[model samples]
Target: MEAATLFPARAIRLRRDATIRAGQGGPVIALADASLQLPGLPSRICALLESLACRDVPEADVQQDLAADGMPGLLRWQALVTKLDSAGLIERSVLTPQGPVARLRQAAVGRGPGSAVRAPAQVKLSRFTAIRAAGGKLVAERPGGHAHVELETAVTGVLAALAGWTSAGDGVAGLSPQLSRAVIDLFAGAGLLAPGSPDDDTEYTDAALAQWSQADLWLHATSRGTRLTSGYGGSYPLAGRFPPLPAVRPALPGPRVELPRPDLEVTAKADPPLTEVLETRRSIRAHDPAAPITLGQLGELLYRSARIRRVFPCADGQEAADRPYPAGGAAHELEIYPLITRCEGAPPGLWHYAAADHALEHVADPGPATAALVMGARAASIMAADPQVVLIVTARFGRVMWKYNAIGYSLVLKHVGVLYQTIYLVAAAMGLAVCGLGGGDAADFAAASGLAYHAEGSVGELVIGTPASESASESGGNR
Candidate 1:
């Protein structure tokens, strides 16, 4: 298409009527030969007049049809039409049968049976060059966007999940994982997954879909602290506000290590039934094997508290990531690593929760003291035995800093709060006792995880099992 010219005369010959062209007379006149020159006429007006000469149709239908063409505001079309009328090139009349109509006569040449003569084509001229300046290329015609109904539905699901609906135990995404996945895939395919640059060059990088999924984890984690008189807890407060503590051993045990392979299945169903165990759940600092928690029970708890709920395809349409929890701006920076000790359902070893697969991958067997060591100075007194398992919530600063600028730290703080709380509530609902440990030795935790000590990821600890009496009191009986 040619660049739009100002006031170009646009002529239209109605396919159903005779051809219309501009005549030489100052006023539009019927033409025998298509040659005309109007005196004292503005060059800009000629462009619009010519555009009107190209098509043949009722002036009312033609004008109304042109008005419906783009995303432009109505005020703009009204102003342009008024300019043409004032220039005397076009006139409007209310015909008894046709209602209101706009037409051109004289200098315009077209033959039709109707007594009323209309502009052959509607000529639209932009009065201000600024109005023609477009933000970007006009979007391509989207054919079969009808099938994109699925995509629309998926986008809706993602938006709903982001809005806290999924975290509320709504089960919309959980029950329809495929739908959620489809939504992300559609967005990626549609080029809607661009990771726009962040304000802070040093902090947040970009808002990619992977980061979005990670943000989901943070959101779901923090959703547990739903009821609050003040914004003291919940995902919002923790966004980059609290730095992660290093992993350290409790006085009673050696420095924390990745534990040994547990006897439980990573995804197995534990005995005493998850439902029953949840009912009997309590914070017991000590565990009695006589209570022998089965493999399936362990898997159920892990899935409920930390499993990946959905994966979103990136803008490139080639990569994908998981969002086990909802995130704000999709800035995910936390990694959940488990320190398993006595769970019958899982091997007594270190494992990473793969949100993508909703499965656990073994990291190491740090031995029996692993739990005690992770709790560090925060552990129960020496008389108290280690709990069944400890979950280490690690933060990867780079993950967040990429999308959010330096202010991305705010997002990280929110991340920690959300993930930790989700662990708390889901555990509580399952009848498992959980505690959000304060400070830990951050340096030691990184060394154990075999990942760098960079700000991209850090440790947030949650010890689960029968909560000990003293530990329960330390929580101010909040359980």
Candidate 2:
């Protein structure tokens, strides 16, 4: 047989305790890190194996030691080594530098150094969890899968060491080469070991990092289906209780005016086809200052696009109701507040669109800054005049938050996109002009709307008006 050398892989620990009783077969020893319970070994054999834990020993010397200790000698030694190798706990070879260093050299020269140099085997425990079970058995669990392996309670120390409770040097100090190899192999199979380092630098931009708060990022990460553990992907009752539905805030007690509900069937037949509308949709910035959009037109737009077509309680006892646009869990949490700058029939002011009753509830007079913002958008759009109405889309986060967890914000943004597209399509069909703003300052919106920044914040904005025929022609075709 060829000569062999042995060394302990990192983070393998062996423990002997009263719990490890000697049965009819042999004394049982637990390999904690590997979650293995090894039985069938005589007292002499156990003693012989323990002696090899502290340092490297030649194959011949190990065989001699086993024979001297009144054990089955080389045959037993070879069998144990094979078992450990399969278990991933020990290393047997003329070792050399590997891992990161090897990867670097390989990348630079297309090949790594030959197998002449010698080095100690290095191993680290991968992230995992071990839990005690009802029957005194231990269970080892790792991310990404539902499978778990059973282990002996006595070997818990080995798992703890692999979990980083102790340094690699300390954990593997006295572990037999075979035992160490078994632990490594078990963890590697289960993907419970550290991943290999990449040769390239991986970093994120400062702006990208700053865009999302740490808590926000954590919520997004945990809520995603890909990152979530099993039994966490589907919607579940929060704390085993459904929260009460927020009573539709009755049109902020102000000057309330009923809106005209235009006949939907008549409008659909009269308007251009869906395909034509979609193709013709454009962000028209220029408005006819002399002929602002009629108040009736504004009311019709809101009615067709955002008005609650119907409202019914959800079957699951969750405080959710279905609406025109698809919302996560049917939670129609978006609220519209129109800021009119130059409507023909409506006074220039901030008005909330009451969806339940389909009415405009005057909230407040538009501040100078709000008016300036509207005019600035018109100028940016190269419009002849300011838009007739600037719609501020705000989200009532609590409605969705009570039903969803980490994915709540992401869902809200998606709803905003849906609403934006709905508005674009509806405006195109109505032969009206519309522009969706890329972003708006939430703080500025809060100050103008007098709404709390946290509970209800602006998520999007859109400008709408009657496009000047001459200016529209000058702007050329759809863009």
Candidate 3:
């Protein structure tokens, strides 16, 4: 494509967040930690990007700006555009004769070939694409999308047109032909547009896409694959808007059962080797009903696996703490609730493990909802009988959310997995049975514990108990 068509109407510009600096190479474009060098760039081109540093420049004007140095027009100009595109530093505004319509930018660290569309054919919004109003602008993105766009609500008609498989040209709805095409191109470049029926290999029949539900794919992409412009890792997006959640949830008013702490120094020396713990770890579904896990054993397990080691001050006067298992940002957002059905010394009830205190607080009497949660665990396990206890893991979401955006919940789940591994290893070392439940009924758990579902809800579940002696023979089946 020629420069005029590639950067229509001088709509290309340096992203507001980007900076240009003189470097060992010709010039460097820096945004966040990303940097792109232009070793052989014409000096005229370098000045052009510098002029764009503090403001927007129409792409069509790029050559005109270059002409000041007597180096205007194609080859040299196109080379700079290619380098900027590779650096993910270009932001383009789509212009109609009357006004600017929308802007396209890179949301992820890399780029792709963009979505495909057969000319004069049916095109539709990809099932993974989500369009929503944010901060008075319409933001569109798809799972793992690298390209992102923000547009005024005026072009919402374009989205309405592509809501389903409509003719490609039909996508032109509320704007001039050029503006409408530009909007379509923005969505298409972001992989939010898909070839609809009558185009070979529709997204509906894509085997890889078929395996991903919208939520799963969204989580997977937002957490790992994509770097959203919204930000990542300790960004503290909510600092001024909302106060951070307490690093340690305040004590719930209830009868506290002070648990005994294990002698860590002695155990560290005498506990089974790491390899033995790793090898012997098994999800013992058959917990011994006759010989239930004891209060002392439960205390030791919690102390070894989840107790807080220290607390320290962090950004915005927020507190952060360390625990036996690793957590993203050391937020230690997870709170453990033990559902005791047959622990010998402790009463059968729902209890919250206070990590800071190394004690159990009886939160509620065993009720129908509690029984249902226990049953849910048993159903998930390959048990000889109901396990001795079920552990519900929850996150005080704001603990992570206050510090991170776009990937907060993802960090919470990862923290849960690490906590699960810690518990499994500790239980195995103690010759106790422990199994991590894949999932649980969050609504049921909230009802039983009387905790708010959104603020604090179950994110993971596990069962723990004394392994039935004979059931050890069936370990293979459980594994």
Candidate 4:
């Protein structure tokens, strides 16, 4: 065992509540905010722990102090130290060029141990920003609002160096030993720094799975359930003021072709019942490329599934629109882009469906890559031939993020799911084939559409066409 020292973990505090009745047990001394709990200990034991928590103590000094106080046997002290180490209350120090870097035993923000400590390696800073709190104290908050640690703003330069803003020669070279250790300890506790070699692979390569980053997952988890803060739940006047409804994005500039859709009141009589459609909804992959989907069928599908039904006015002079499907904050952030391969009366191209105008805005001619993507979708669905149309559901993330703070991206994904079901049901009722894709390359979509990946990117893809005669016959009773 290498010589080690122990220091109190971030945010940990001892709470000694009112004493229990004589027969019940000893007074409960709770160790709060650590990775694990230490409770129901005697007063003497609590006092010993409290003393240890005050400052960093070397292992030899700790044992000497314990012996001087007539604390207990060495085995008992060792057991307590083990428990503290397991709970991430102990940070091991490793010597580095800057000074000693404190490494946490467990995480403060993300899934793994906060940060590894490798000698002679530059600390990798996470996406944590420093904010000034009351009394002129600086607090660094981890990404996704998970954890925070307070430190002196004077150490900002050190943090910047960790983030690779400063030259390696100057990086941590002038930082005092005490300040460097404190900054490293504080950053580790907040999960703002990680240990990584210069040659380490830091990029998350699994783009599909990495879409929902650790920060995203953390915000999604913490912002749900009870309405604890203004930024969460159905609480009105979020962050002190009710957010004005976002202006609907103007239809993209292109050749616009209006769609013909029957009024719902009139179509209600001719359309299949809702219950019947629900029961018959099946993801049909086998489509009859021979029988291409008509333009009228595509128009009806869009109008029935996504068109804006009504706009409700607010007292603040802003308006909220309701679509055929439910949306968080009544923000219809999703835009439909059709990748046409073989639709009747529609040329092979990329077109944007404008729900508000009930029109298709021709964006661009589908390049070979875009056509290949469509073919890939067809192959994934196990289809013998390509579908007439592939609907790429892209979301304008800003529309949702404008109002909701933490869980905005999560709500966008939920809206995508809701729209998928709506498309499925409408397709079933119309006797058309539809298959929702599991995942897609956002970069590919961006390349094809000339849209920024972050602003407007594909979330869901649904291939639609007329079903094969044999397949339709097999699904006859349900249909």
> What's model 1's lDDT at 305?
54
Backbone clashes in each candidate structure, one number apiece?
Answer: 124, 14, 5, 0
- TM-score comparison, 3 vs 4, better candidate: 3
Ranking by TM-score: 3, 4, 2, 1
- The 0-to-1 C-alpha lDDT of every candidate, in the order given, reads 0.42, 0.59, 0.77, 0.63
Q: Residues 1-479, candidate 4, lDDT per residue (tens digit)?
A: 01211232222222122122223343222333323434455454555566544543444555665675464555666676555543334444333333333322232211333332222335556533444464565555554433444444444456656665222333263565444554565565555653344465243333543465655555655566222223554333343454443546577887878888867787778879999988877788777757799888999999999987777775544456789999987878898998999888788888999888888998889787687768767766666677778899998876666566656777888999999999999888889888888877788788888899987888888889888765452342221
| Candidate 1: C-alpha lDDT | 0.42
- Candidate 3 Cα misplacement greater than 4 A, ranges: 1-10, 18-76, 108-121, 171-179, 195-199, 202-206, 225-230, 240-246, 263-274, 314-317, 382-385, 477-479
TM-score of each: 0.38, 0.57, 0.81, 0.59
Clashing pairs in 3: 10-58, 10-59, 10-60, 11-59, 12-59
Show the lowest summed lDDT stretch of 10 residues, model 1.
124-133
Tell me each candidate's RMSD, in Å, in order.
Answer: 22.6, 13.1, 5.2, 9.8
Better of 2 and 3 by lDDT: 3
Give per-residue CA lDDT, model 1, range 103-122, as digits (tens).
12212222212222221111
Candidate 3, residue 101: Cα displacement in angstroms equals 3.0
Q: Which stretches of candidate 2 lie over 4 Å from their true place?
A: 1-201, 204-223, 229-242, 372-385, 470-479
Indicate whether candidate 2 or candidate 4 has the larger TM-score. 4
